[model samples]
Target: MTETARTRYFLLAILLIALAAAWPELSQPGLLNTRGGGDSPFLLQRLQQLETAVLDGHFPVRWMPDANYGYGYPFYNFYAPLSIYITFLFRLIGFSFVRSIHLSHLLGYFVAGWGMFLLARRWFAHGGAGNGWAGLLAAAAYTVAPFHLVNVYVRGDSLAEFWAMAFYPLVILAADGLFGGGRRGVALFGLAYAGLILSHNISALIFSPFLLLYLLLRMRFLTKKQENYPQACTEQSRSISQITQIGFFKSYKNLRNLCNLRIANPIFGFLLALALAAWFFVPALAEQSLAQLDAVTSGYFYYSNHFLGTADQPLIQSTFFVDYGVVDREAFRMGLVQTAVSAAGL
Candidate 1:
């Protein structure tokens, strides 16, 4: 067999191994239900409040304290109602809130995986490295990522992260289109971005800066292309020269080109997005924006830990890059490196 076949088979083997490792976690009921009964119960309680308010025609803007929790609502300043609306829809259809949330995660995972595959395909095509294998690798890598696995385990605010991860590929497509890649990519991008914003406000906030930076990079690439136009012009260079000779006018034209991306290819897809978004956006926004808000004392927990001498407790922090466990330093170090290497597909 050829080297490519060998590599493909190897990747397939690795994928199967990973999936096998994940089976125990996935097979168990509520495997993603990390909040367990305590947090899950609280989450359901919030959804119940949201359901009542929506049915009553006034979903509160800020969250109200759950009678059971007694403490004020912890999620005041940060609020996004996509998950709540999803739960409410299920409740309307006779499903329990917990079941509805679980179903949403299960379904959302499919969308995320498919979207990632398509996005990776498009990206590889654009990069002149058209490999379906690469796309598959990326899609699988993202879907079974540690962050995603952890989210499944915790199964609370992490739902937002899952939604964000799922839509990320589309965002890249849209940004690419905005820079003159293609109308379809741009349109898919806009619809994806809007859906992401509506699903998780915090994720949108975090993603916006990266989107803007990509635009900036594309603009720079255009400038470099113009500068490389030859002194003795070919047809392409003549066009470039004519355009670049206009100086500020050329700059303005480039900016306008980047900004005015009217996507026509994905009209149907975007329309579906619009329909889904309409179901929840306004009500969710109203509830989130108007809810009684509070400012948590940032770092208070950290400071309080110091005061109690528990600050010295070993930390187990896991996210994109940082993974540390204080319980066993040697094990932690070995695990971190191994996990990082595996994640990088080494």
Candidate 2:
């Protein structure tokens, strides 16, 4: 197929998947009325507060007046803001709160699918191992993945995490491009990384190690020495000082001779992201003790209590039925067909 034809087909597929995923909310507006269950109701309440705060021209809205029974709390100071801002934009454009939330979910699926397609296509191109069809299938797999569905439909619909997940593929793709001599690659990577950071701090933290690994792998290729260093080293055993000198000179030589822009691209991107997100993170780190962070770490909602296999019921039972309570151990699950497809893909 022509490139345009392929693009059209891919878009159509994404639209179909998004529509299918959002059908429940679209068909029955009442379903959206409930926001989500459990802490989601609390999230919706916070979003309402955030919306009012933004609309009232509260710059860098840190304090939530409605929280803690009007005594106020620094909810926005630490919470990620990108998804909230997007939903606020939707509200500004005349969408109701419920509709805006649902639309965000739909958009998340679309963006994530597109990002996955771009990453897969770029990786395939670099490896010279597959074609566009591989990328398309990969995108499809990601868009309808069971965990993604569960997140959207079952698990309090944590829109912030969904937004972060949506940006993950884009960040990786931008990083790859930065290393591969693409135009404005550093800027693109910075924007994508910033988006990931703003969307969900926890997801950004989870992705950091993988991002570092990718940079290291790319650096290996970008800084490969052309000289026969092994032969030079084998010529004679050297003292510790001499070995240090050789290593320093080799590193300097690699930096000097590095023709590719890849080595500096990710570093620039990392610095730029830190700069962009400093406003939020700075207070978050400094004022952490003031918030009830301990409540989050250890309480009824403690992280330790939420692991898999901690549920009293069988995994199979919990996987199929939606939990009515707030603290179900496994709130997300893979559908039978999705599990089969995942296994096949594996």
Candidate that scores best on lDDT: 2
Q: Among all windows of ten consecutive residues in candidate 1, which has the lowest summed lDDT?
A: 228-237
So what's the TM-score on candidate 2? 0.79
State TM-scores per candidate.
0.59, 0.79
What lDDT does the true structure give each of the candidates? 0.54, 0.69
RMSD for all candidates, in order, please: 9.5, 7.6
Deviation (Å) of 163 in candidate 2: 1.0
**Residue pairs in candidate 2 whose N, alpha carbon or C atoms collide under 3 angstroms:** none
- Candidate 2: residue 329 Cα off by (Å): 2.7
Model 1: residues >4 Å from true position, as ranges?
Answer: 1-38, 59-78, 92-94, 126-130, 155-157, 181-187, 223-294, 300-334, 337-346
